[model samples]
Target: MKKQTLLVAVLAALSVQAGAAVPEKTADTVLKPQPGQTQAAVWASRVLTKLHYKSTPLDDAMSEKIFDRYFKSLDSEKMFFTQADIDQYAVVRTRLDDAITGENLSVPFAIFNLYQQRFNERIAYARELLKTKFDFSTDESYQYDREKVEWAKTDAEVKDLWRKRVKNEWLRLKLAGKDDKAIRETLDKRYDSYLSPSRKLTNEDVFQIFMNAYAMSIEPHTNYLGPRAAEAFDIAMRLSLEGIGCILQSRDDYTVVREVIVGSPAALSGKIKVGDKIVGVAKDDKTPMTEVLGWRLDDVVALIRGPKDSTVRLEIVPADAGPDGKHATIALVRQKISMEEQSAKKTILEVKDGNVKRRIGVISLPTFYQDFEARRKGDKDFKSATRDVARLLAELKKDKVDNVLVDLRNNGGGSLSEAVELTGLFIDKGPVVQQRNGENKVEIESDTNAGMAWDGPLGVLINRGSASASEIFAAAIQDYGRGIIIGEPSFGKGTVQTLFGLDRFSQNDKVHYGELKFTIAQFFRINGGTTQLRGVTPDIKLPTMADSDSYGESSYDNALPWTQIKPAVYIPAGEVKEIVPLLDKRHEARVSKDKDFQYLAEDIALVKKQRKENSISLNETVRRKERDTQEARSKLREARLLATPGADDPILVPDPKDALNKAIAAKPASGKTAPVPKVAGVKGALRSDDGLQGSERTLAAELEAEKAAKAAKDVLLNEAVHILADEVGLLKTDTRMALRVLPYAADTK
Candidate 1:
């Protein structure tokens, strides 16, 4: 992990959104309010019904008190808030409990109002603290210090921290090129956007933060799925959306790009790389831009992501620049991102050892995904990722691939059932994993039976993005010694979520309908090892992400501790130790001074340094200089790769006479045609951005249409065949990871 603390914070922020807002609703049995009943009580009754609360005989005062207590307890330190901050919230909390018991609107409304007010105050405090400084490196340290101090001491301490922090931040800002005037102006703009009435900060912001905190408190996996948040996630996973195809996050005041999907219009346009701060968004040059400083990341994303085929202009402060730097407006076109690009496809490399030929099979699984909607509709034709993988394996087997490499890098897991099924493809009948629910009950999911698809020398490649179900599959394979695990430690997401419907309890038109995602279970490896904060250990120790933001379980806030129940019996295929030295040697030889690897290493270091800083200048000139340096570096890297032989060579289509390639494309499912040929003399070879036919085809004349179609169909299979022919039955490297338990956490890689 780059900085363990920062990594943990970011992971917590990302993972805690799964199993949140566990709603505990009661049935609203109240028929109606009495004629002489107070308006507060009458209104409360109706509201309770609408909210799906089971109306009890209890009165208004009690309900208010209960709700108040729940809110305060969740934020006791006033880091969000504490009981001491208010004089009579204690009474209000009591009243809330009573209000929920009966249908009293007055007390319920009052409680709701109080909650909103306190929530607003909490948001204010959080914003202020962002601008302040602190010596505390961890949340625990901050909590401890907060608890020890009295009110007066706390106030003074906070003030002192702020002064010191602000001064340091200001210095960084100056270096980034912001003068005092620019700084003031920027701050004024931010204040207007964040605190203005039009923004709805007091209501919407508080709601969001409260939901986030609530999710974190329950369990790392549980989360409140706000409509907008859900929408954002869907767009991200689909790898397509309007506006820019960049993932953004809020760090204190600025909105930063966390990741950029490769080949997106933004990436293709040579504009707006990761870590860029989005200062403003506009529809066109004639339109006035909206400054987004100090806004929530979600809100900023909402503004950027819109309808498909639409364009949005962004004013960006590229990383490595100061204030008063040149801000460029980048235009981007939204296009559907092909999932195949992210998947593990095949490539053939020629390797000769004393006239011996070997073939290697590369299959990339980007997230263990199975489209739930398609499955639920009983659509047998629905895209089953496992099925595709199984077919790929079968084809590879025909190609006589000597070794198989399963790439799972950047795959944040999906579809639990798919994980088990995917794992089943490699092993015989056995327990896959154990799940422990809230009541401490356990259920073991087992593979019914298994026939190995293509069990040649296998290697599973993982990275930080490989999490949850992905971790489970990788861990199982590692434990069984079925394959070698390569790359980095898997993401620690051991929890399982269950959705609870809230619509069933609501009454009337107020629509208290929603879903509560709760962490109902924790996943355990068959060997009885927990993958909670400690993800699966890789077999080969790779030197990557050593200083990257990718974090293990321990990095997450309030993450569940790693523990074991009992190990499930599992048989080992082979010990990985026998090939450790050879794998190490190969990796060393392959990566040593390799330009691509070296560039990646340098990029990671620079990014780590950039993330650690808190403030930068608002000046234009300085910012432009920084942006230029980054752009130049990127262009240089691209040029270098192009200069390398075979590195930038376009993929070639398989020839009909290629036997090894033909073996890889024996069959194709209906409606799923074979890949097109990449050869120059092919139909549908070159097209516009939106008209990209396939990776297998090259732009050519229509006179060669028939030949081109056949050629294109064999491209994927041909590559697979070539890989298999060269690597199959050759020597294999096994040592993938060096696992050890450090004092802080388990090292998966």
Candidate 2:
């Protein structure tokens, strides 16, 4: 909130609450900025109005929108606030436009204060309800997802919801085999932390949070970063951290592990998993574990991060946990994650077309990474996504692969320059993408590089997680008809953000205002369609982990709408549009008869069906049976796949020298390490003409690492290979039909 609102002592002067039943805050408040956040907010507002690509006006229309978004962010599920509370907040809701320019944020701060008071009431009542046991015998259902539900009318209404919530949590703990005493202790520690909400917060924190609600109300990608958040942002750009090596975010009251970096302590530990909810954290073996249920994501991060070799025990609720399942605690050592292991990797898959076997190369890019410092120092070998992928493409060409698949699953995007340059490797020189600024000015980013690396049949594999630069490259390839897109729709993060450090705007350097990361540009494909929310649709769809309806850009309410301008003039190279139908037909037929694909379809069907359910059975018997049935089915499917030949496809392992393969080497059956075996002409764990790499790794460690990698591989990628093979089959059948031929394509021969 703006600094001019009030001082810490002002709480004593106010006896009346603004619009809610909240009384004067008896607890202490974080110090507001002495100068009020007016300077920062006004500055940000002015910049955004002039620079943000959306160029949306900040009138009372946006003001009310911001008000709604602020509360939605604080209480996303509509559980904490009532219609009366919202009614009370109506005044401030109309004053944001003036307040932002005038440097007045009293209303926003007031709303936040009321939110805190309501949260306290809800949590305290929940603690009391936890004191008694719940009657699971009664057929009661709780709607866990209340995002679209109506606000409760009275305290009684909310109290009933909290009771069910508390009961459900207790039942899960009891199912996990914890005693009543243990469950109560856990609940106690969790609830007690809730009484104090802003204890660790600074004025900057409040200002950032309030302003971010405003900014994000304009669009999903625009945000405000406090000083601490800005520092962390820079650290992430460096792609290294001294911590448990897992990315974390606050989801509801739980701290969720978002991504586990390979070669880091979390990934190497073999215990941590993505989507795991961390409830409590302990330092070393002796220190008492502290509950972090109500802690801010940054605070949880601070607790998890420490000096190398320090032990951090994490009490985790597995991602797959049901309402009546147990959680476990695991200990891991803190270490530095350098992100070297997250670089682009290469492997080869052998696909059979008719009676002949063809080798198809695959490149997996985790992110669009670049070593800016190294490049600035004139290091020719500086690591970068474009450079690395280019080198890998050359290697694939040397091995004479028939087709190439670019695996961009879960690649959330980076480095726009890399995205443009990467597209150059596939298509002839032309406009790659168009960028429109806040002023409605358009600039075309083109690939002037005349050289092409891979002009053969190509496919890109994407899912809801592929975004930003991933969308740019994929869109450009699709626009140019350079490749066929396979898999789910990409994440619709077409907006471009630029970080501005607030210190530059300040006259005083002693105290730093935070930073603003606002959207400066939006990406448009060569076909002139903006990728804003309607991300690049794939040529063919594959069964995904989650449907786009449940995830991706379309899920956000404030995302920019997709639109189109005049298409950039460029001749299409390939008949991908015509070929896609044939490939789709073959794919449908293959997956229908394939056992692995059948199991995949069945699993996906189950998940989608489960997603429609608002409530699950509270009875322990029913829940246990559900879990057991799922497990039994999974085991049976696994056994069947393992027994079938070609059902177990091995991933191409990246060379150890390039990427950090620090995962615990797979143990050999005899407890002995063997040199990489010569198989299928695969050398050093890379592809050659002979066969696929199997024994190229020290057998003991190679096997284990391959096993781990295989378990994580989805059936979609193997399907992508089959689709690519079909394209190759088309090309072989009609050799006279030239498809997107590179000017220098003969050089590969």
Candidate 3:
């Protein structure tokens, strides 16, 4: 009682809103518990409170956090509820700890029920608003980023916000030349999609979301996946299947294309990109694309994905397109390939570094993936990143490429074992990364493989999206003085998480509990510093949006801190640090005058400027003028670049059939690409007695990889080549890292 009183006083000092208990009434009914949900939630809580790296105490303080998170999750934008709603739910806010442990599953379900009710009302309001005409001439603006604002005091206040929100969207569509009738239909469909999904949110779904709110409060990556989501995880891990091969995420009530997976139908079609919105889908070329703006993600995915050789047409709103802006129709042929995602691709780029035209080999590795099934089956020719990259390096040697750029941008890590093995390709066997488990025990992971793959003029290209095994690989290269690290700091995802199946702990076969991902270990770089939050900083920094703290591991409030322990026992392979200054100097001079690089800088600055905007003018004429001015400037820039043939790709409506051909045509003259050599598809390059037969040559695979690199138009990669070229000409091969080393905190045998 004394400890609880003291904790309440401490929370009061902190002035946390959720910690305060105000006078309130408990609702009559909360959600009914699923058969095994109570036990699963309790088990998940115990594991989190015990094993998580933060080890946050399970007390009133944590209860307050969980309450606040649940409320925020239910109504983040405050569009669905008013202050009265928050006050009414106050009784259950402080009772979550009891609910989780004692099987009183009422509070979470009750809150979700209220949220669903409010959301339904909002959807109805939106539909009505769409029916009415918006006078865009009114001099008004919508404050879009509502995250910093407080909840509306009344339903009337929220309705006004939603009205302006609907009006702003309508105004944009009007500016894009959409008529009232078409705009109404578009909005109707969008609202319908949003409302339609609410019906699908079963008690299990709501429970999962509420539970995740608690799990996420502990740490960002740690979470509880319900059965449905767990099955999706199973599919994603399989890596490849027949579909459009487009990665998607739900943003702003639309399915946004996160990535057009390389070598897939989406990439070959060339209509999809990072921020493009899939507003509609069609079954075939003859059918009109169905609008999918507010549609559930899985439903939208089901509509697009089909069997191999089948076609799905997509209606896409390009990233830069405004509301009602021109939409492109793309049709893609689905192709099924088994675990081709793990394959390493190589491309040689021809660039002028001073008077010399250097053939810079760019080896693009998407992830550290291995065919676990094949390896388990004792297949010697099992496709693995280490083997593929090693073979690609050998091909690079054959081509006599002047320098190498290992592009690791946007690569969410996969296999940790593969990271060590890949590092082994560069430096002769040594310690790679240290794993620190839950008990503070340390284990050294090393690359014991013999023979260096390629040691000359290596550069690793990374971005803020790079993480986990990517960090391990980059840190090893930097620490060993093996290569020059370039681009923004990587995503600091060094903590290790293992999924715990909840079914194992359930009382009986009444219901199948899901899985809990709990952080159990931390990864330390070979140099002793953990890449938990402060990721591997580059030796040569590049212009990037990730330079800001808005992205990557640093953005999470509970992310682990950067700490240095002790360096592993290993000799420096070679010193590339000695040449960084020279590389940096050359890089600076080049980017300052380089047209492509200047465009990247200008684009980044413009994005940053736009991110600072607090509101947008809702006045129709003013908004149209602003849009026109921006569009005009973009068009003029595109025209100038097109005239000179710069690699900066202007938005174009491409014929799906020509995209692959055009990509192939973009390859440099000395570059090569082909089917993954006879070696790639076969077990071992060949039998000891067999001779090379068939049309499968290594040249085409190298050439295809080259073509893909050209299609991507990577600025950082080009600069890496220039930097490497400078090193080759100016620095001695015997150079070594001159940075002083820090010792390990304790010995790990």
**What's the lDDT for candidate 2?**
0.71
TM-score of each model, paired residue for residue: 0.55, 0.76, 0.74
CA lDDT of 266 in candidate 3? 66
Model 2 TM-score, all chains together:
0.76
lDDT of 3 by residue, 1-749 (tens): 01111111222222211111111212222345674778788888888888786787666667778888787766665677788988987776667888888877877887788877787788789889987877877888888766557989988998999899888767766776778887787777766656544543445656776787889888778888876566455444445566877777566567877655656766655456666888889977777767777655666766776788988888888876887899888778877644454457777766654566667788888887766666889989776778889988998888887667899998888778889999988887799999888678899999887768885667899999899889999999898888889988889888877778888887676567788877778889888888888788999999876534457888776777777778788887766666788779988997898776777788788777766876888887897787877666555444443343343221222334446855674342334432221212222111121111111223233334344334544456667766766665664332232221111101110
List, residue by residue over 1-749, the lDDT tens digit for candidate 1.
32221112232244322222211211121122222223222333343333311222334543443353344333333332333444445555445434334434344333335543444443355346445433322221112223222332344454444343334344334544666666544543433332332122222223333333334443456554544445545543443345655666654457776556544666556556555778998765456798987654555666676666777788999754666778877777666543444443554333343456555567778766555655789878555557778888887777765567777777778767888888888776677888876567778887786567755556777776688888888888887667677777777778776555444554534443334555667889988888787677776655456432336566654567788888877666545544545555655665565566677678877866664553333333554466557766766564554343343222332424446544343223222333332323432322112211221122123325544343332222222233333223223221232221111111222
Between candidates 2 and 3, the TM-score winner? 2
Total clashes, candidate 2? 9
lDDT of 1: 0.52
Residue 108 C-alpha lDDT in model 3: 82
Pick the lDDT winner. 2
What does candidate 2's lDDT look like per residue over 1-749, in tens digits?
Answer: 11111121122111111111112223566334346377888888887777777787888999988888777766777767888899876767778899888887777777777776787778788788767877877777777767666888887787888888777777766765678898787777666654543343444545666788888888888887766667566554546667777867554457777666655677666677766789889977678888877565556676788888888998898776853458788988887667656778888887767677777899999988776666789988766888889999999888788889999998998788889989999877889999887677888999999868887778999998999999999998888777889998888888888888777888887756677788888878889897778787899998767566647888877778877777788876566777788889998998888877778888888877776786767776776576668657756665654443463342343455443333233222234432232222212221112211222222334434445446544468888988887787787775444333322345323
Most TM-score-accurate candidate: 2
Ranked by TM-score from best down, the candidates are: 2, 3, 1
TM-score for candidate 1: 0.55
Candidate 1, superposed: residue stretches over 4 Å from native: 1-198, 201-208, 227-361, 391-402, 438-441, 544-550, 574-577, 585-749
